[model samples]
Structure formats: structure tokens, C-alpha cells
Target chain A: MMQMADRIKLKVLDPGLLTTVQDSGRWGYQAFGVSPGGVMDEYAAELTNLLVGNPPDAALLEITLKGPTLRFEEEGWVALGGADCGATLDGKPVPNWSAFYGRAGSTLILGFVREGCRAYLTCAGGFDVPLVMGSRSTYLRAKIGGFQGRPLQEGDVLEGINLVEARDEPGKIVESIRPERDSDLPLTQSSTITLPPSLIPRYGSPILLRVLLGPQEDMFEPEGVETFFNSPYRISHEADRMGYRLEGPKINHRGKADIVSDALAKGAIQVPGHGMPIVMMADHQTTGGYPKLGTVILADQYLLAQGKPGDEVLFFPCTEEEAIVAWKERRDHLSLVRAYVDRLWRKYA
Target chain B: MSVSENPSVRFLAMGEACVVVEFGNTIDPEVNERVHRLARCLQNLLSRPEATTYQGTFYRQEYRSWSEVARAGIRELVPTYRSLAVYFDPLEVKRQALEAQITQLLQEIDVPEPAGALEAEAGSQREKTFPRQGKTVIIPVCYGGEYGPDLAFVAQHTGLSEEEVVKIHTSRTYRVYMLGFLPGFPYLGGMDERIATPRLETPRTRIPAGSVGIAGTQTGFYPMESPGGWRIIGRTPIKAFDPFSDTPFLLFPGDFVQFKSIGEGEYRKIEESGGRP
Candidate 1:
């Protein structure tokens, strides 16, 4: 375990909405019924960690819907990422994606965001938190992680280490910084894949996430499958971290519903007796009942996660190879981006 | 390329980090059996010297370079589930050999149930082979007070007096069907048919922890404060679980729980004394 320096007793004074500490996530224990819990927005969480010089997967505080009033007992640097929560520090404005040099005994207050549900606060050297299993992410339902696996409320102290020399400005890494920042926002998410055109999905946009039929996919009739791909569905208000309930024309399996309980996946769109398909999410249980018509590709989970209720989402059938090809292309593009960013940082300077 | 009976079993790449070979679509015994077996097979297929295997044989492989082994490395066992997802960092896990190695293992292990028995007998035989950690704790409950405003209502539904309701409730042993919906909340099974009830039309936003409730042929304890619709007959002083503690839950899958009768005054003493079950 790594001990962080300059530990600050973060008295919440008040925890607004849901304030919990998070990290990349916990994996490899779903058989025990443990949800792979962590930061809902992993891309933002990692970026914030890297900005503060912590390894990308380091643990951080995830402020939900609203932020908390935090008072630092010691001075340190913290990077705020994910959601544009109208953030301001000490009654003045603090920018997102930039590190703030906070002084000792100062109060940091955060407010609500118009677009996203969560905002990440990454301390200088990551939070000095013990990990359960092989991760440090907070599993709220199991109540095991993040300042003891519970939401931060009034009078909670969050601790972290200072391993990085505080950064000066955005630095020469400014190459494409504006575009990168814009991409991180809600508006710029292209309906089409953003990588090299050659790496583009064979399917047409709006992308219909094709799953190579689930084991239970046969339970549904052929028309059920056809309606699934052609028809449009709206996300319901009953959605949360666990899963999203789609509201639309109730899907039918041989014109009947009520499937024998079966296995399910996050993104497995289940057509319950109501015929309305419920798409499972990160916090979905290890097993489930209901006929799962299809699943969203693992690659497009982030896209699905960002979508709010009432957004119209359509499904397009895809081959298993197409899904694998998309994943390989994504990884390759990510590497290219990382390399380009690193070289630009040095060359421009 | 092949399909099996477990309908929802599919490989879902959570992200860049890991892949899950999930089994089942619901809380049925057959689905659960396949899920556990697949998990166990994965543990055996991906054997690493550094991994620390725990009870139930859950193992975590520690790789200095996660990306290499992660590629095709995770598809070690096709074990009768729907499918298994493969995830790894291609930039980090540069070796093509890792994927081939796991694919080789996948083909070698086809009999699915390493614990023994054939694929068809997953439900009945698998549980006997696997050793599940079980606990039996007697919880002291005070019924039919303000803590249990619905106690009389439950009695009326079951066509029994409040006193008789207590007697019947205390007599049977309840199996914790599962621990879900909330942390440590017990989804119990095996309630007497006479006492079965449907949930309320409207749900209470905040049901206190330890609120013993009856809903649809099952009696459960609300291990945490959450919205609920069960008919609450009483409350218990037991903490039920504390995640910070080593053993997070006071109960487990095969645990047997009994409710001992108590009164408001006795309940107060137990609460003030801080006695644990």
C-alpha cells in the first residue's frame, strides 16, 4: 500500500446529492455477485489522474449530480475532471481539466452540472485508500471502498499524497488541447466513430450496436429481432448506474413475454413481459431473468453511458468479427493519440 | 462459435481492463451453478504463481504487464456459459502468443464442470461439490409496535392472530436466496405458504435497517436503509453487516436465520446494551 503525504481531513460540511470516492473500477469478481464498481466516467477519471501525476487508474472522489463543500486541512494540488459542474473555488472560478493549487485550511465548494451526472476530483498523488480485491473503486451497494465504502457527507476527510511538482500552465501539450477538451464535452460526441476513417465500423450511423445473438436470443421470434433492429427506442427515467429501461413499442417474443430467468450482461437488452427492453449497465447483477434480445458492444458502452433518458437510440445488427475489429481499431487509435500527444509536448516546446 | 442452454451467457468487454464470462439471466439455481463453474474454470485455466486463491477458489492473476496476457489470454475456458469477453491493452500486451495460449486452453477443457458431474446435472450436483460458507444467527425481534405498524395487517392477511404469527415466524428456517438489491439485504426463501403476501402498492422511501418484512412467500430483513414495500412485522437490533469489518455480511447464501420474540422494553435494553447477535 502507498501512503500519501499532506493528509487533509475533508469535512464535508454537507454532501450534496451523492458524493463517493471512485477509481477505474473493480473487475474479476462478478461470480461473487460483486458489481464492478468505480467511476462512471472512466475517460475523465483517468485524464484527471494523469494531470495530477498519479497513474491513470488511481482512486479519486466522484461527485454526483451535485458537489460537496470540502475544507482542506493541508495544502495540495487537485485536478477536476469529467462534467462541467459550474465549478468554482474559494468564491472564484476554477477551470475544469486543470490542476488547482489549494492552500491549507481553505474551503472548496462545488455546485451542480447541467449535462453530466458525475465529476471526478483527483488528488495530487491519488487518494491514500486501501483497495479491496485488486481495485480501489467504491462499490456503494456493497459499501466497501472510498473512505470506507460509503458516500462522503458532512465532516469527511479525504487524504492523498503529493508526488508531482505542481504544473505551471497547460504547457506545450496545448496541441489539440482545445479540440480534446471539446470532445470531452457533451455536445461534440459524434454519432459516427471519430478515429481514422479506415478504422470505421462497417455498419452505418447512427450506429446500431450489433451483438452476435445471445444464448436466449432464440427465445424471441424473428419479427422481435427485426423490430429490435429497425424500430427506435427512448431511454426511460427509471435508469441509473445499474441499468437503463428503454421506453418504446413493447417488443414481443412469439407475441408472448415472461421468459424463464436467465443469464444477463451489462448492455444486454432484456425484453420483459411488458415488452419494453431494459438495457443493463455497470451495476447490473451477476445473473438475471428475462429474454435478452441483444447486447451493446463493449466498445460503445461509453456512448451508452453518456446518453440520458429520452434520447432516441436505435439498434443495428452486427457480426462478432465486426465487434472485435472495432475494439482492435480503438486500441490502435488510442496508442496513436498517446504517442502524438507525448511528441507534441516536447517538439513544440 | 457454439451455443449452450444458459441463455444470457455472453462475453461483455467492460472496458480496456477486463472481460467477464458471465452466466445466467436471473436468480435461478441452474443459471447460478453455471456461473460459478465458469468462474472456477477461469481460475484454473489462468493459473499464475503470484495469484492468491481464496475460499470458493476465487483467484486474481497478477501480471506485471497486463496488456500482453489480456489479449486472447482471457478466453481460457468456454465453460458451458454463454460466452467470455476478452479485454487487454494492445499497446501494453504486445505478445500475440498470449492469446494463442488461452485459446489452446479453451479447447482442452470442454467437460465444463471441473468439480465433477456432467453438464446436465449442474443444478443438483454442483452445490454438493462446492463448499459454501454458511452462518446461522438468531436475531431478536420486537413485533407489532410502531416499529411494526403493519404487523397486524400481516396477521390479517395470513388469517392468524399477532401472537400466532410470531410463533409461526419463529418456527421455520429461512434460506437467504441471495444478497442483493441493497447491501447485505437478505432475499429469503422458504416461507410458509399461509403467510405469503404481495408487496404494497406504494413503497416507503426509507425502510430502516433490520426491518423484518414479509413479501410474496418470502420474509427478508432490510439490511440497510432504502425504499421498500414489504409488510414490516418488526425490527432487529443486529447490525446485519458493516463493510468496514472483515466479514461484511452477518449472513451468507446457506445461512439459517431465526427470529426470537421480544417486547419494546426488552428491545430498548438490547439496543442500549449494544449486544450483538
Candidate 2:
């Protein structure tokens, strides 16, 4: 049981490269042309929330290559997942893929990311942001959802739900029911634990992405389609939350490289008249006019989202069945991770 | 006017999670209506309590509601001018089962005849208007001056007077074909060819929200401040997108829009009232 508090605030000391509140995504509004803005790395976001004992879609801060410096105004458990940015708490190093309790007035700082570009910082009870279109993810262009519908800036204060932090006393029986604490009292003890190395994602450059052949495969010449699969494309500097523009071999279209603008999937590889591919991301428009040659499977989008500018990407065609099987395997692995985390919490508590 | 009643339709894989039901190769209002019809049919099917559960698992987990259940399995249906993209959860519903269900629903759908073709058969070239189900929103615009920086350019390109440009733009009631690009941004149809203008060579970095612009044969108002290449001729005072409201978007795919000219004073008044006008 958790005591109710009006606000558990996180004062933003430094709003790094780009810090925005994100969840799984905003759904059911794409038909109305709302962009499905959310966390770039779904695996990391969900894992971060899981470690914090929060719902998979609970809102968390999405820290980009450079992470933000935040100070907790209240005692709460926090977890960092995805890219390892060498996060430090009160001058002490904090490990990724783990959950740690932060005392009130403690400062958390994140340095330059070493490998992956994006990471998620999740609080115990999730960020208490208004749910716009069933999500807390920020869509900057529309100025909707998340913390004021924008990225965190200096002087911004984010409020988190006041939930009871798990504190385990030595040799005490594990209680199934957690007792509610007074709202004015702070959590006495905090425990830290990290997932096994095998569970953590390892990022490497020139990432190989599995793509499913398209809704417009016939629109491209066979050689063009072959070129797309065989060649490596470098992500250009034009990459952002909306999409990534890749510089690669010309994928010459059989006809015009345009279509009646249609619904766009999250990882749609769209080629406009210029013959280069643009991989759609979390903040992609609901529909686009460019002919999409293929789509990076939803399960594999985390790989694309982690790739930074100038990172090389090689695509391989995959069947829809294979993609589904991969997704199911990933989902099963996630369930296993959640169970393992719960068991660890029980052992420590 | 010899358009086939049975158009070539295909169920193409958008990805593992989505399947696009494409009706035609080109844009057509008839195809759009069919897309919407299929979407509606699917919506009606998913809303049923029986359809709420999949493979013995309840779609609604917590705070179970009709809307929550409807979001399970098949999550969203994004209808475009020529196709309907159905995004589903492969974990809940298998692709084959979902495809079969959609095929069954497609068979149940009554494909409406092309309204334009029917009108042509009646010996008239007039546009056949569908039964207006939604209210027609009249957006007041302040054309020319600071609000419309490209009004002179548009008039010169169209070889018409500045006033003629405004008159021609407002004369016809445009059908909202679809919403895309940005939130609440409507892809409108029925812009007169006489006033069709080319997009700017260099797109502006920031076109304010409510900017009425012309690009090729299309005319639409920006629902948010965004960079665009369209030639802006005016600006509207209406809040086309309100993300906080129950109905966040002020317009829909089937809605009708008419732009009415207003002076700068009236525009200020409407702006002050927060789109009350």
C-alpha cells in the first residue's frame, strides 16, 4: 500500500540533449492524424518500468544521447535502462538495468552515452502526467501529452506518484501486503539490484536490422529492391524523433516513387523521389505519400532507435511469419525478465 | 464514367502487425468511402462483447470498458484515400485469423457506388454531395497583409487579382478527404484548378498554425506550427487542433469546410475568444 501525496517532484537541474516523457505510445488516435509519439526504445522503456514495479506503459523520461541532471524532491525508487550513459547519483556511479532508491534531495546525473543513443529513466510509481489520447508520451509538434507536451527544460518540475518503496529488513518474513506509510514520512531503507548481463541489451555499430518486404515492393525495380537489401546505409544528421533519413545506394523506382499517402507503420522505410530511404520513428505522421519499400518489424525498432547519426545499418528481408515468431520470442523473454525481477525483489525484501 | 463496381482490391502486408487493404492505385473519393465503410464495419464488429475476448483471454484487463476491449487484438484502423491500414496485435490475434475476419467483414460491407459516376449518369457534371452527417464548420480567415505574406505571389501566379484569389478560394465548399501531415491537418479535395499554384522553392521554417496554403491542386490549413513548402495565402483564427478536448480534432475525414473572409479586427476578436467564433 502506498500513501497518497499531492506531488513527488523531480527538479530539472540540466535538461540534456533531449529529455521527454514517454510511455509505450498514444493509441487509437492515428485515424485522426495524431502522431503516435512514444518511447523510441520500447524494450528499454518497458524494462525500466518493470524494474520499478510499474506498468509496462507507465510514463518515464526518455533521455537521449546526453542525459539530464535531475534532483529528487522526495524519496522514491528509480530505474535506468537502455543506453549506458554512466549515470551517477550523489557522485557515486549507478549501474544500468537496475533499480535504486533515491533519497529526497539526492541529485542524479548522466554523462555522455557510450554506445546507444536513447535511454529511459523510470520512477517507481510512474510520472504523474495527464494522459492525452491514452498516453503520456510527448508529441512536440502537436504540443500535446506528457509534461506540458514538450521536452524537459531547465527549471521544469516533474511530479511522480507517491508509492510505498519496498524496504526489506534482515531476517524478516516477506509480507504479501505492503503497509501504507504516512505521507509526511520518508522511506527509511533503499535496496539496489541489477539484472544479469545476459538480460541486458548490448549495442554495436553497423547494426543489422531485419525488414519485411513492403506494401510497395512492386513499385521498385528488382535491382533497386536488391540494392536496398544488399547495401549498407548510413544514418544522416537529419535523424530525430520523427524519422531517420539514410544515405544509401539509389533505390530506383520502376515508376514514380510516390503513392496516394497512406497509413505509416512505426518503422516504415519510405523512399521519396530522391531514392533514399527514410525510416519512420516514434513521432512519425499517421500517413505519408512516399512509397515504402519495406518496414522494420516492430520488435526490431529498438535497434534502429539506438543507432546514432553516421551509424551504418544493413537490412535483411524477413517474412511476416518470421517477424511474428521473433516478436513472440521477445515477448516471452520479457515475461521471463519480469518474473526474474519479481523473484529477486522477494529474495531481497 | 465506366468505372467498375468491383475495383481491384488487395490485402497487402504493411508489416507483421499491420495489413493494408488497398482498394485502388490512385486517389478516388469512391475508394475513400469504401475504406471508411470497411473501417466502420470493423469498428462495429470489434465493439461487440463477443469480439472482446481473443483465444480465451479477455482483451480488457483493468477497468474493463467497451472502448478498452475494442482496442484489443485489432488496435487501430487508419483509413486513407485509397486504402485502409489495419494494425493489430500479433500476440493476441494471429495474422491469419485477423485476415480471415477482415475478409469476412469485407464481404459483409456494402460498397457504395461512385457518387460522381452516378451523377454523370444523370446527365450532370455537378459534384454529388454526400448526406451531411457532421456540421459544416466555417473557418474565418484574414486574407492578405501580414496574415497572408504570399497573397500577392499567389495572385501573380494565378493571373488573378488579390481579391479574386480570396473569392475563388471561398466560393466552393471543400470536402475533407483525410487528416494527415500534422495533427488535425485536413487533406481537402475540390480546390479549383484555376487557382492552383506551385509550392515555394524554399519552404518556410515555421508556418504558424491555422495557415491556409495552396500546393498544386490541394488547399489545406495547417493545424500546428510546422515547416511547409505550400504557398500561404491567409491565416485562420480557429484552433483546428485541441489535444486536451474529448474530440481533440475539430475536423474529420468526412467533414465539410468553407473559408469565410474576415477583417483583421474580427480575426483579433476570434483569436481573443480562443476560437469561439
lDDT of 1 by residue, B192-222 (tens): 8877778888999888877999888879888
Question: Candidate 2: which pairs clash?
Answer: none
Q: Ten-residue segment with the worst summed lDDT in candidate 2 chain B?
A: B123-132
lDDT of 2 at A312: 95
Separately for all candidates shown, the number of backbone clashes (residues 3 or more apart, or on different chains) is: 19, 0
TM-score of model 2's chain A: 0.91
Q: Give the residue spans of candidate 2 off by over 4 A.
A: A1-7, A164-191, B1-7, B47-71, B111-135, B263-269
Once all C-alphas are superposed, what RMSD does model 2 give against the true structure?
7.0
Query: Per-residue lDDT for B90-129 in model 2, tens only?
Result: 7776666555555544543443433565445422211111
- The alpha-carbon root-mean-square deviation between model 1 and the true structure, to one decimal in Å, is 9.2
